[model samples]
Target: MNALIVAPIVLPAIVAALSVLARGRRQRVGAALSLAGCVGLLAIALALFAQASGGAVSVYTVGDWPAPFGIVLVLDRLSALMLLLNAGLALVVLVHALLTGVDRKGWHFHPLFQFLLTGLNGAFLTGDLFNLFVFFEVLLIASYGLMLHGQGAGRLKAGLQYVVINLVGSTLFLIGVGTLYGVTGTLNMADMGLRIAALPTGDRGLVQVGALLLTVVFALKAALLPLHLWLPRTYGGTSPVVAALFAIMTKVGVYAIIRTTTLIFGAQVTGPLMLPAAIASVVIGFVGVLAARGLREQAAFGVVGSTGTLLVAVALFEPRALAAGLYYLPHTTLTVALLFLVADLIARRRADHGDAITPGPRFASMGPIAVLYLLAGIALAGMPPLSGFIGKLLILKAALAHQAAPWIWAAILGTTLLAVIALARTGSTLFWKGRAGEMRHGAVSRLDLLPAVALVVLLGALTVGAGSVTGFMDAVAGQMFAPRGYIEAVLGQAAVR
Candidate 1:
C-alpha cells in the first residue's frame, strides 16, 4: 500500500474536523487553515497522479482488512486526475472567496468548504458503492451550507430546491444499492462487477433494473436534461465562488456513469441507456443557453450543453471516443468553472445591469475581463486555437468511426454553433454595447481578479501542452476500456476471473 494513497482522503478529513471545531472563531485562522489544507491536498494529488500515471494502482485497505470485506481507497489515473483538479479548484475558489468577502457571508463557510473537499476526494478514491454514497452525503451537506453562503432570498430559495432534489436522488441511490446488494451480497464495486458479469441470464433482469435506477440517480447529479432543471437556478443564484467550486460537482455524476458503466456493467448495457440521454442533454443545453436571461444563467446552461457534448463522446463507447471524452472532461470542467467567476466579475462592475444582455456601466478591469471572456467564449464554443478546439476535433475524429457518427456530429456541431451565437450576443451586450454616460469604476479586489486570471492561464497551458495531455488521456481511455487491471488491483489477482 502506498502511504500517499490514503493521504488524499485522510488529509481532507482531518482538516474538515479541525475547521468544524474552529468554525466561528477568527476569520484569519479559518482562512489560514483552509489554505493549508488545499496546499497539502495539492501536494498529495500530484504525488498520486505521478504514481497512477504509470499505470499503477494504489489501494489502501481500511483497518488492515482486504477488499470485498472491508472498505478500500483506490487511486488510478482518472481518479488521481480528478483529485488534482478538485484541489486546485478549491484553492482558487477559496482565494476568490477571501478576496471578495464571500467567506464572511457565513460562519461555517470555511469549514464547509474543507468538508466539501473531503467529500469530493473520498468519492473519487472510494472502492465501494456504499462509501461513495457516504461521501456524496458529506459533500452534499457541505454544499447545502455553502450554496446558501451568501444571504439572499434568491439563494435561499435555490438552496432549498437543491437540497430537496438531492435528497430525492439520495433516496433512489439507497434503493438501488439495496437491490444490488440483495442480488450480489457485496457492496464493494469491483466485487459487485465480478458478480454481475458472472450472473445467469435469467437473473440479469433485476440487475438491469437496479443499474437503471442507479443511472437515474447519477444522471440527476450530472444534470442530464430532464434532470437538469434545478441547475440554472441553483448554480446561478449561489455566490460566484461557490458556483465556481460547484463547476465540477455535476461531473461527479459523469464520473460515476463512466466508471460504473465501463468498469462494472460493460458498454453493451450502458451504451443504450447513456446514448439517448447524452443527445437530449446536448439539444436542451443549446436551447437553454439561447433562451437564458442573465449571463450567469447562460453560463450555467452552457455547462449543461457542454457536459452533454462530452457525454455524447462517452456514449459512443469506443476507446477513441472515450479517450476524446476524457480529454474534454478536464477542459470543460476548468472552462465552466472559470466562466462562473468571470460572470461574477462582469456582474460586479455592471451592477445596475445585473448581468442582463442590455448595456451597463463601464466597470473596472474591462480590458482584462474582455480578453478573458473572449478566450473563455471561444473555448466553450469549441472555436479554434484552444484546448476546446482540440478536444472537439478529437471527438469528431473518433465519432466518425462510429455508426452513429452523423447524429453525434449533428448534436455536437449544432450545439456548438448555437452556443457560439448566444455567447457572441452576450459578449457584445456586456462589453461592446452602448455604455452609460458616466463610467463608474467599481472597487476590484486584486485577489478576486487573480483567481479568475489564474484559471484562464491554466486553460492556456492546456492548449500549449495539448500533445502531452492528449497522450495521457489516450492512456487513461485504454485503461478504462480494459477494466481487468483495475479489477485485479482492487480485488486481488485471484479475483480477476
Candidate 2:
C-alpha cells in the first residue's frame, strides 16, 4: 500500500508524455488517453482513501533513501482527501471539455491537464518543504498554458498577470524554504517540526517570519484578499472548462495552509493571522459577487467568498471547527464548479449578451437552464436542502463557543445574504425579463448539462450522507491536531509536542 503512493504522481507523468506524443496524430487519441488516465487516477485515489481511512500514516521514500535526507511522499487523511477531490474534479471537467469541444481550442490541453494533475498530486503527497515548492512550480507552469488555452486578448492579458503573480509567489516560497532550512538544517517537514519545537528561544522569531512568509504565499494562491485580485479576471476570462478545473487549484493553497500549520508551525502562530484576513476575504469576495457585471465574474467572486468561509473555520484552529471547515471545503469546491458550468451554459445560449448579467432574448431551453441556475444559486448561497447549508450550520455550531463567534456568524451569514441577492438578481434578469426573440447560437444538450447536474447530485449525496461524512471529518481533524502519528510515521520517533 505504501508503494501505491507513488502511482498517482507516476501515472499522470507517464500519461502526460503519451498525451503529448499522441497530440499530433489525432486529438481523440490524446483525449481518450487523458480520460483513461483520469479514471485510473480516481481509482488510485479511492484505494489510497481506503488505506488512509484506517488512520495510519503511510510514507513512501524515494530509492530507499533515509528520512530527513530523502524524497518522501506522505499520505494521511488530508492528503488522501485532496487526491480524491482532485481526481474526481479532473474527470468531470475533462468530460465537460470533451463534450463541449473546449479541448480542441488547444492541441496541448490534454498534456497540460495531465501535467497539472502530476503537480497537484505531488504537492499533496510530498513530505518535504522543498519538494512542495517544486510541485508548486510544476502546477503553476501548466496553469499558465491552461489559462491561455483558448487564446484571446483578455485571456492573454489575464494569463500574463497570472504568470507574474505566481512567479513572485514562487520566489517567496524559496525564500521561506531557505530561511527555514538555515534555521533547522533540514527540509523534511516532520523533522522541521521536531527541531522547531526544540529550538532555543532566540531563533523562534525568525522561524515565525519564515512560516508567515510561506503562509502569505499560500494565501495568495488561495485567493485570500489583498492577494485575490488575480482570481476574478483570470477565472472570468478563461474558458469555462479551464475555469472549472482551476476551482480546485485554490484549494491547493488552502490545503497547504492546513497541512503546514498543523504539522510545522502549529496553528497558534498562523491562526490569528489567518482569521482577520479570512473575514476580510469573505467581505471583499461577496462585494465582488454583488458588483459583478457578468455571470462568470460572479462565479469567480463566489469562489473567493467560499474560500473565506471555509478558512474561517480553519482559522479557529480548534479541532471541531477544523472538522467543520473540512466539511465545508469540498462543498464549496463542488458548488463553485457547478456554478461555472451553469454560467457557461447560460452564456453560450445567449449570443448577444454572452454571460453578462443583463437581460437578453430568451435562449433555447431556457427553462431547464434556469432551474439549474436556481439550484446552483441555492447551493452557492448556503440555502436549505443542500450541502452548503449543512456545512455552514456545522461551522456556526462549532464557532458558538469561540469569543469571535459573533463576528464569524455575522461574516458568514451576511456574506451569504449578499450571494443570495446577487444570484437572485442575475437570475431575474437572465430568466424573467428576457427580450422577444429566442436565440440558439449554442444550444445546450443533455450531455452538456451532465457535468453541472452531476455536481448538484454529488452535493445532494453529500447532504444525504452528512452524518457519516461528518464523522469521518471529525476523525480526520483529530489526526491533524494530534500530529504525533504523522511525525512518527515519517521520523521514526514520537513528535516532541
Candidate 3:
C-alpha cells in the first residue's frame, strides 16, 4: 500500500527526467516516454482507487521518519478518487495532443507534461501544507511552459497573466503557511488540526485571518467570482490540448479546500466566505457565457459556472450535499475539457474564422464532430439523460433539506436555464447556420476526434453507473467528515485525541 501511494509521485518524476534527457532530435522518443508514463499513471491511479474504495486509509512516511516532522503522503477515498480522475484526464488529453501534433511544437512539451503530472499526483497525496505548496509550484511552472508551447502573442500574453496572478496567489500561500506554522508550531495537516481544535480563543482571530487569506488564494485558483478574470482569456488563448489538460488544474484548489477545511480548519470559516463568492461566480459565469462572442470563450465561461455550482454544494458543508458536489466534480471537469477540445477542432477547420460561433464553413465529416459538440453542449447545460443532470439532481436533492433550500434551488435551476440558452446559441451558430463566403473544407482527422468521443462515452457510462458511484461517494463522505482516523494515521493512534 505504501509503495502504491508513493509510486504515483515518483513514477512521473522519473519519467519526466528521462523525457528531458531525450531532448532535441530524440524529442519523438521523449513524447513516447511521456505517453508510456501517462498509461502507467492511469493504471496506478485505478489500483489506488480500488484499494481506497474498500474504506481504508494508506499512509507513506518519507525517509522512514515519523509524522508531524517528516514528509508524509496519505491516501483515503477522496485522494484516490481524485488520482483516478486526474490520471484518466491526462491520458486522454495526451492522446489528443499527440493526435493534434501539438506535442512536437516545442522540445519541452513531453517533459513538462510529465512534470505537471508529477505535481498533480504529489499535490493530491501530500499530507502537509508545505509539500502541498511545493507541488502547486511544480505544476504551475510546468503549466506556464505548456501554456506557451505554441508561442503566439495572445498565448504568451495570457501566460504572463496566468503567471502573475498565480505568483500573487503563491505568495499568499506562503504567508498562510508561515502564519500557520507560527501559530501551531507544525506543518503537518493532521497535527495542525489537533492544535487548531484546542486553539486558545485569544489566538483564534489571528488564525482565522491566516486561514481566510489561504481561502482567498484557493478561491482565486478555483476561479470563484471576481478572481476568475484570468480563466476565459487564458483558457481560450492556449492550445486546445493544453486547455484540455488544464481542466484538472482548477480542481487542485477545490481539493485543497476540501482536504484542509474538513481535515484541518472545519467549515465554520469556509462556509461563510465561500457562499457569497459562489453565488457571485454563478452570476458572473452565466453573464460571461451569454456575452461570449466565440465558442472557446463560451466554453471557458461554462467551466467557471460549473465550478460555482460545484462549490455551492461544497460551501454548504453538509455531508450528503458535499458528496453530490464531489460526484459533480469529475463530470464537470471532463465535460468542460471536451468542450475545449471540440472548440479547437471546429476552430482549426475554420482556420482564420477560428470558432467564431457565427455562421462559418461546414466541416467535412461534420457528422461526428457536430454530434459531439451538440451532446457536450447538452451535458454542459445539465440536460437530462447525462451525468450532468444526475449530478445536479443529487446536489438539489441534498440541498432541499437546508434552510436556504429555495435560494439554492432557484439559483441552480435559473443559471442552468441560462446555460442552456448560451449553449443553444453556440450550437445554432456553429453547426446549423451557413456562411456566405467559400467554405474551407479542412479534413477533420478521426484520430483528433477520438479523445472527445471517448469522453462523451464515459459521460454516458457515468450516468448509467450513478448508483454505484454515488454509494461509494457516500462512503467516502463518511471517511472525510471525521478526521480522527486521518489524524491518527499520520500521528499515532489516539494522538489526535
Candidate 4:
C-alpha cells in the first residue's frame, strides 16, 4: 500500500479541523497552514503521476482491510492528473484570497475553504461508491457555507435555489447507490466493476438505470443545460473569489462523470446509453452559451457549453477522444478561473470610477490585460494554437475514426458555432466598445494579478508544450479505456476477472 494515496485526503481534513479551532489572527495562520497542506498535496500528486507513468498503480487500503471489505484509494494516471490540477488550483485560489484580504470577510472562510479541499481530495481518492457520496456531501456542505458567506437577500435566495437543486441530486445519488449495492452486494467500485460486467442481460438493466441516475446527479452538479438553471444565479451572485473557487467546483462534477463512465460503466452495454446523454449535454450547452448576455451570464453559459463539449469528447469513447476530454478538463478549469478573475478586475475597476465603466481615449490601453483576456477567451472557444484546439482536434479525429453516430458530428459542429458566436459577442462588448464616462483606475492589488498571471502562464505553458502533453494524454487515454490497471491497483490480482 502506498502512503501517498491517503495524504491528500487526510492533510486537508486536519487543516480544516485546526482552522475551525483557531480564532482572530490565528485564522490567518490556519489559512496559511491549509495552503501549505495543498502545496504538499500538489507535490504528492505530481510524484504519483510520475510513478504511474512507469506503468505502476499505487494503492492504499484504509485500516489494512482488503478491497471490497475496506475503503480503497487507487492512484492511476487519470486520477493523479486530476488530483494535481485540483490541488494546484485550490492552492492558487487560496493564495489569491489571502493576498486580496478576502479572508477577512468572515472567520469561517478559512475553515470552510479547507473543508472543501478535504472533500475534493477525498472524492478524487476514494475507491468506494458510497464513500464518493460522503465526500460529495462534505464538499457540498462547505460550498453551502461558502456560497452564503456574506449574507444578502440576493445571495441567500440564489444559494437557496442552488442548495435545493443539489439536494435533489444528492437524493437521487443515494437512490442510485442503494440500487447498485442491492444488485451487486458491494459498494467498492473495483469489485462492483468486476461483478457488474458479469450480470445477465435482464439483471443488468437495473444497474443501467442506476448508472443513468448517477449521471443525471453529476450532470446537475456540472450544471449541464436544462439542469443548469441554478448555476448563473448562484455563481453570479457570489463574491468574485468564491465564484473563482466555484470554477473548480463544476469541474469536479465533470471529473465524476469521466471517472464513473470510463472506469465503472465502460462495459459494452452501459457505454451506448452514455453516448446519447453526452450528445444531449453538448447540444444544450452550446445553445445556452449563445443565449446568454452580460459578462457573468455569458461566462456561466460558457461553462455549460464547455461542459457539453467535454461530455461529447467522453461520449466518443475512443482512446483519442477520452484523451481530448482529459486534456480539455484542466484547460477549461484554468481558463474559467482566469475569466472570472478578469471579470472581477473589470467590476472592481468599474466600481472605482463611481460605478461607471469608461475607457480611456487610447483604444490600445490595457493591451496586456486585454491580450490575456483574449487568449483565454479564444482558448475557450477552441481557436487554433490553443489547448482547446488541440483537444478538439483529438476528439474530432477519434469520432471520425470510430464512425460514431451521425448526431455526434451534428452536436459537435453546432456547439462549435455557438461557442464562436458567444465568444465573439464577449470580445466585442468587453474589449472592443468603450463606455461614455471618465476612466477610473481602481487599485489593482497584487492578489488579483497573482491568479490571473498564474493561470495565463499555465495556459501558455500548456500551449507551448502541447506535443509532450498530448503524448502524456495518449498514455492516460489508453489506461482509462482498459480498466485492468485501475482495478488491479485497488483490488489485488485475486480480484481481477
Candidate 5:
C-alpha cells in the first residue's frame, strides 16, 4: 500500500526524466514513454481508489520520518478521486495530443506533460502544507513550459502574464505558510489542524490573517471572480491540447481550498469570503461566455463559471453540498475540455477565421462536428440528459439547506441561462450560418475526433452512474468533515484525543 501510494508521483517523475533523455530526434520515443507512464498512472490510481473506497487513509512517510517532522503523502477518498480523475484526464489528453500531432510542435512537450502530471499527483497526495506548495511550484513550472510549447507571440505574452501572476500567488503562499508555521510551528496539515484547533486566543488573529491569505492564493488559482481576469486570455491563447489539460489546473486551487477549509481553518473562517467570491466568479464566467468573440475564449470563461459553480457548493461547507461540488468537479472539467478540443477541430476546418464566432467557410465533417459541439454545449449549459445537468441538480438540491439558498439558486440558474444563450449564439454563428469561402482543412478523422468523443462517452457514463458516484462522493465528504481518522492516520492515534 505504501509503495502504491507513492507510485503515482514517482512514476510520472521517472517517465518525465526518461522522456527528457529520449527527446530531440527521438520524440516518438518520448511520446511512447509518456503514454506508457499515463497508462501506469491510471492503473495505480485505480488501485489506490479501490483501497480508499474502504475508508482507510493511507500514509507514506519520506525517509521513514514520522508526523510533523518529515515529508508525508496521504491518500484518502478525496485524494484518490483526484488522482484517478487526473490520471484519466492525462491519458485522454496525451492520446489526443499524440493523435492530433500537437506534440510535434516542440521536442519538450512530452516531458513537460509528464512533469506536470508528477506535480499534480504530488499536490493531491501530499500531507503537508509546505509540500503542497512545493508540488504547486513543480506543476506551475512545468505549465509555464507547456503553455509556451508551440511558442507564438500570443502564447508568449499570455505565458508571461501567467508566470507573473502565479509568482505573486506563490509569494503569498509562502507568506501564508510562514505565518502558519510561525503560529503552529508545523507544516504537516493534520498536525496543523490539531494545533489550530487548540490555538491560543491572542494568536487566533494572526492565524486568521494567514488563512485568509492562503484562501486568496487558492481562490486566485481557482480563477474565482476578480482574480479570474488572467484565465480566459491565458487559456484562449494556449494550444487546445494544452488548454484541455489546464482544465484540471484550476481545480488544484479548488482542491487546496477544500483541504484547508476542512482540515485547518474550518468553514467558519473561510466560507463567508469564499461564498461571495464564488458567486461573483459564476456571474463573471457566464458574462465572459456571453461576451466572447471566439470559441476558445468562450470555453475559457465556461471553465471559470464552472469553477464558480463548484466553489459555490464547496463554500457552503456542508457534507452534502461538498459532495455535490465533488460530483460536479470532474463533469465540468471534462465538459470544458471537450469544448476546447471541439473548438480546435472546427477552427482547423475554417480558413483564416480560426475559432472566431463569425461565420466562415463550411468545414468538412460539419454534421459530426456540429453534433459534438451541440453535445458539449448542452453539457456546458447544464441542459438535460447529461452529467452537467445531474451535477447542477445535486448542487441546487444541496444548496436548499443553506441560508443563502436563494442567492445560490439564482446565481446557478441565472448563469446557466446565460451560458445557454451564449453557447446558442456561438454555435449558430459557427455551424448554422455559412459564408462563401474555401475550407482549409480536410475531414476530421475518427482518430482526430476520438478524444472529444471519449469525453462525451465519459459524460454519458457519469450521468448513468450518477447514483453510485454520488454515493461515493457522500462518503468522501463524510470523511472530510469527520477528519479524526485522517489526523490519526497521519500522526498516529496518540496525536489525536
Candidate 6:
C-alpha cells in the first residue's frame, strides 16, 4: 500500500530523468518507457481505490519520517480516484503525442510531459499543504515548457500571458500558505484539519481569509469566469496535442478547489461564501461562450462554463452534490480534450489545402465532419444519453434536494441555453457553410483519426456505464466528507480523536 502511494510520484520522476538523458532513437524509447510508467501509476491508483473502498486510508512517509515532521502521501478514496483519472488522461495524451510525432519533433517534450505527470501525481497524494503548493509550481513550470514547445511567435505570445497570470496566482498561493502557517503553525493538511476544528470561533475568521485567498488562486487556474481571459487565447495558440495535455491541467485546479472545500473547510466559513461566487462564474462563463464566434474560442469558453458548473456543485457541499461534482469532473475533462482534438484535426485538414481552419462560410459544406461536430456540441450542451447529461442530472437533483437559491436555478438554466446557442453558431459556421474558394480534399491521417475514435469510444463507454461510475463517485464523496479514515491513516488513532 505504501509503495502504491509513492509509485505514481516516483515512477514519473524516474522516467523523466531517463528521458532527459536519452538521445535520438532512444528518445522514442524514453517516451515508451514514460508511457509504461504511466501504466504502472494507473494500476497502482486502481489498487489504492480497491483498498480504500473498504473505508480505509493508506499513508506513505517519504524518507521514513512521521507526519507533520516528514513529507506524507495519503490515499483515501478521493485521492485514489483522482490519481487514476490523472494517470489515465496522461497516458492517453502521451500516446496521442507520440502517434502525432510530437516527440520526434523535440527531445524535451517527453521529459517535460513526464515531469508534468510527476507534479500531478504528487499534488494528488500529498498530505501537506506546503508540499501541494510545491507540486503545483512543478506542474506550472513543466506546463510553461510544454505550452511553448514548438516555439513560434503565436505560441510565445500566448505562453507569456499564461505564464504571467499563473505566476501571479502562484505568488498569491504562497502568501496564502504563509498566512495559513502563521495562524495554524502547521503545514500538514490532516494536522491542520484537526487544529482548525479546534480553533476558537473568533480566530476562524483568519483561517477563512486565508482559505479565500487560496480559493482565488485555484479559481484563476481553473479559468473560472473573469480569471479565464487568459485561457482561450493560450489554448487557441497552442498545438492540438499540447492543448489536449492541458485539458487535465485546468481540471487539476478544480480538483484542488474540491479537495480544499471538502477536506479543509467542510461546512465551515469558506463553503457558504463560495456558492454565490460559483453562480456568478456560471453566468459569466456562458456569456463568454456566447460572445465567442470562432470554433476554438467557443470551445475554450465552453471549457470555462463547464468548470464553473462543476465548481457550483462543489460549493453546494451536499454529499450528493459533491458526488455530482466528482462525476462531472472526469466527464468534462474527457469531453473537452476530445473536442479540442477534433477541432485540431478538422483545422489541420483544412490547413493542408491552404484553406483557413478557422470557421468561415466554407465550413458548412463538410457534412461528415459536421456530424462529428454536432455530436460534440450536443454532448457539451448536456444533451440526453451522453455522459454530460448524467452528470448534470445528478447535480440538478442535488440542487433541488438542498432547495438552493432561486438565482442558482436561474443561472443554470440561462447558462445551458447560452451554451447551446454558442455551440450551434460555431457549428453552423464551421460545418454548415461553404467557403467561396475552390475546395481541396486531403486524406485524414490515422494520427488524427485515432484520437477522435478513442474519444468517442471512451464517451460511449462512460454513457453506458454511467450508473456504476456514479455509484463509485458517490462512495468516494462520502469518504471525503467525513475523512476520519484519511486522518487516522496519516496521524494514527492517537492524533484523530
lDDT of each: 0.86, 0.91, 0.88, 0.77, 0.92, 0.78
For each candidate, C-alpha RMSD in Å?
1.4, 1.3, 1.4, 2.8, 1.2, 2.6
Residue range 1-497, candidate 3, lDDT tens digits: 37779999999899999998887888889888998999999999999999888877899999988898899999999999999999999999999888888888888998899999989999999999999999999999999999999899999899999999999999999999999899999999999989988998998887887788888888988999879999999988888789889988889999898899998888888787787788778778877888899877888888798899889888989789889999899999999999988987888788867878788766655678889988898888899989999999999999887777787788788988898888888887877785645556765577788999989988988899999989988888888898788888889896955
**TM-score per candidate, chains pooled:** 0.97, 0.98, 0.98, 0.92, 0.98, 0.92
Q: In lDDT terms, how accurate is model 1?
A: 0.86
Rank list by TM-score: 5, 2, 3, 1, 6, 4
Query: Which of candidates 1 and 5 is the stronger one according to TM-score?
Result: 5
- Name the regions of candidate 5 deviating beyond 4 angstroms: 436-444
lDDT of 4: 0.77
For candidate 2, the 10 contiguous residues with the lowest summed lDDT are 437-446
lDDT (C-alpha) at residue 357 in model 6: 31
**What TM-score does prediction 6 earn?**
0.92
Question: Poorest 10 consecutive residues of model 5 by lDDT?
Answer: 435-444
Error of 2 at 13 (Å): 1.1
* TM value for model 2: 0.98
- By summed lDDT, which 10 consecutive residues of candidate 3 come out lowest? 434-443
lDDT of 6 by residue, 347-443 (tens): 7557643223344434322565666677777777888768888888788878885656577678877788887887787766666575767464554
Off by over 4 Å in 2: 437-443, 494-497
Clashing pairs in 2: none
Stretches of model 6 off by over 4 angstroms after superposition: 24-26, 352-368, 401-404, 435-443
Which structure is stronger by TM-score: 3 or 4?
A: 3
- What are the per-residue Cα lDDT tens digits for candidate 2 across 417-451? 99899999999999999877766646467678888
Tens digit per residue, CA lDDT, model 5, 423-481:
99888898778754754456457668898999999999999999999999999999999
Error of 6 at 254 (Å): 2.1
Q: Arrange candidates by lDDT, descending.
A: 5, 2, 3, 1, 6, 4
